[model samples]
Target: MAGVRISRAAGALLGAAGMVVPLAVVTAAPAQAASCTTSTGPYQTRVERFLGRPVDGKQSAADCKATQKFQAQHGITPTIGYAGELTWRTMNTMLAQRAAGKTPNAAGKCPTNKGRIACVDLTRQLSWIQDGKKLTYGPVPVRTGRDGAETRTGLKKVYWRDIDHVSSLYNVSMPYSQFFDGGQAFHSVTKSMWNPPGSAGCVNMRVADAKAYWSLLRNGDDVFVYGRKPGT
Candidate 1:
């Protein structure tokens, strides 16, 4: 502590003649919020439908206000009301979660022959466990990988599981992990599952869902992943 000296410009200066000189403190200003935009984004119609608004592709003042509010509520930065990629992706995930409702595998993309299998539909951001033709658990919301780090498709078996695992690479808590494909697994996160940019390839789930997964699934269980995540 004695050897560490604060420069005059950085902190209060030391007095040469035993007179103390005080420096005025400076602090960083808070960032200004983004203004709402009236521009129609590429996913305008989709955003409108998700918001329960008129499903027109045009962006009106009302639509802009609604979107801006939604973005703010969801902690989306630059909440400018544009139906951009991030906003649309978040909305899409939420819609999928709502629509799942006990029929997640209605399309039958996830093979039912595996006896008990965890099905991950990347397109709708939904995950559920099925036993033959019976719904074992879930139809819950999930957030998977982003653009370049897409969650691998096809069938994989759960190779490992940890109740309180920490990611060695990122040094973050990966609670209730059920590893299936390589480094990818199902884990719980503190943040919203639908938050933008997505995960590093693992399937992120809500705490409740992750805990349920820990209880329902075991090592060697089948995990089937299909479809393409909306943004990815």
Candidate 2:
């Protein structure tokens, strides 16, 4: 009887050992591949909408590439090559405003003399050069100031033209600067002005647009800024 009891105890112990062995072996095995889900995040949906995609919340490879491209143009960092929260927020806001037709128009008459003038529509974030009633240049995109640092609206004259000017206050390179209202000027910027946190009262433009403005207008040219920048 004693021998039978000992045999039974030993069998039970062996069964427990068997279970532990497999568990340990499974734990020691190599990890599985990363299962990147197909389901899209909320930010990804916003990005897709901004990009004119179907917005099905599918995180395809192409979607990621497009997001990366936008981030690169706007000088957004990390360049993760993916549509994350920050990328989505910036792009969505800009596109929403544009879709709502909040930008300014170029139909109105130039406020200054008929010789040559630059008309800036703050609401539309557009600027153009006109020869009185005739439109010569553009409705080019521009970046203006934030809430407290609003770009002054009214008639202004380009007092200085600095092709390679550097801002003394911010120490930033302001290429093709056409200073009109005090320190406020039309200059080139690498950062994306479409999103929030705009310039410091100056009119920020693309490098090409700023160069074009520099060539079209001279010092003392009239710069009429009208309308109000949206969200400011």
Candidate 3:
């Protein structure tokens, strides 16, 4: 390591291009092999039940793989096949979202009087479209803005839309974008919506869901966003 250093005189040497540049060397760190564990987590049984595996609460190689796959699908961290709180919560949210499809607006939380509208329930991380009390589209799971950049709540309208929109700020593909709020819209991302630290104020949806939203909603359609996302 000591011999790797360059003296002041040699620090700025002329390159072959005739440009004086810093003489520096960098050594890449060795990459460690990813490991999988069979150690049972606290929520092992719960996870096993959710996955329809044996509810013995014991971790096996197959169980690890299954859990790891779930973690990766949901963008859970570490992806080491652990059935921790984060993973459990994601599972629960998914269950709730599925259940919501049946009676998405049963609570009468969103106004059903609107002719055709999109409703975003931040608390449940769900979105759905309705046509005067008739459920038209989802009660699908969504990823909302996280923490400081929380998705604003209020009644808004479909202000703009771009089918193959590229975000000017983030420089990412925002397909099937239906903008209802300022910089916030309903769009599709390749990422798992269940992933944490959520989206940048937009309602991130799965590919199919977004396509459905694009087909059902049009410009000037009412959009009502309310409630607060859990863990936001």
Candidate 4:
């Protein structure tokens, strides 16, 4: 990753520059050897799926070249990394569009599979293993970035796991169970302020509800977080 001080996502979004979605035209020649698809990269394929297409899976030279061209046209620095920060920003912007009663740039919101992971707009949070057929916005109190630590909005995966209370890269701790990354988790936090959009990047929840969320999680549980600010 570039050591250059990349701006924290939240700040970038709140600024007047606003969020930029990928609306550029693809100009890479089909015959070019470059390829920068997500299929072979570490990023979740769901991102491409969310965008309503299948990535070539290999980051060919053509892919990189194409991406650079796309970035140059969009005025974004073309970096080669699956699910890069810009990708997250674009995804969030698209989600915001959807929340504003617009369909996502992609064809679907999320796949509806039984007991699968998903997000609930009514509750403004994500859920797991609840007969994914219906939306379950369990009243969990997750702390979101109030000062604009704005959580990346899009499809993500609980790729790793841990037992007992864990902490995030940000050093915030969650008591009594499961994985930690980026100072966030599907763990317990006080719920006195239910669904008020008051978290510092971690998903806050009532202790009891946290337990339910824990039980609901399994490695590879798909997670999606997106919605308008409460009462927008």
lDDT of each: 0.76, 0.64, 0.75, 0.43
Which order, best to worst by lDDT? Answer: 1, 3, 2, 4
Question: lDDT tens digits, residues 1-232, model 3?
Answer: 0112323432232111122111111213433424677678998999999998889999998888899888776667778888888888788778778778668898998988888999999988999998989888878888888877788899989866778766433445677877666557788876777888687677888899999999988989999999998776
The collision pairs in model 2 are 103-124, 104-124
Which numbered prediction scores highest in lDDT against the true structure? 1
lDDT of 4 by residue, 108-163 (tens): 35556535664533223333333345535442334443335444566666643443
**What digit string (tens of lDDT, one per residue) describes model 1 on residues 1-232?**
0002223432231122121111111122434667779799999999898888998799998999899888876666678899988888788678767887888888789998999999999999899999998998988888788788788899999866667665433445677877676667788876666666677678888889999999999988999999999877
- The runs of at least 3 residues in candidate 2 whose Cα sits more than 4 Å from the true structure, single-residue gaps closed, are 1-47, 56-113
Comparison by TM-score, 2 against 3, better one? 3
Q: After superposition, how far is residue 76 of candidate 4 from its true place, in Å?
A: 39
Query: Which is the better candidate, 1 or 2, if ranked by TM-score?
Result: 1
In model 3, the runs with Cα more than 4 Å from the true position are 1-33
TM-score, per-candidate, Cα-based? 0.77, 0.62, 0.78, 0.42
Error of 3 at 5 (Å): 49
Model 2 TM-score, 2 decimals: 0.62
Better of 3 and 4 by lDDT: 3
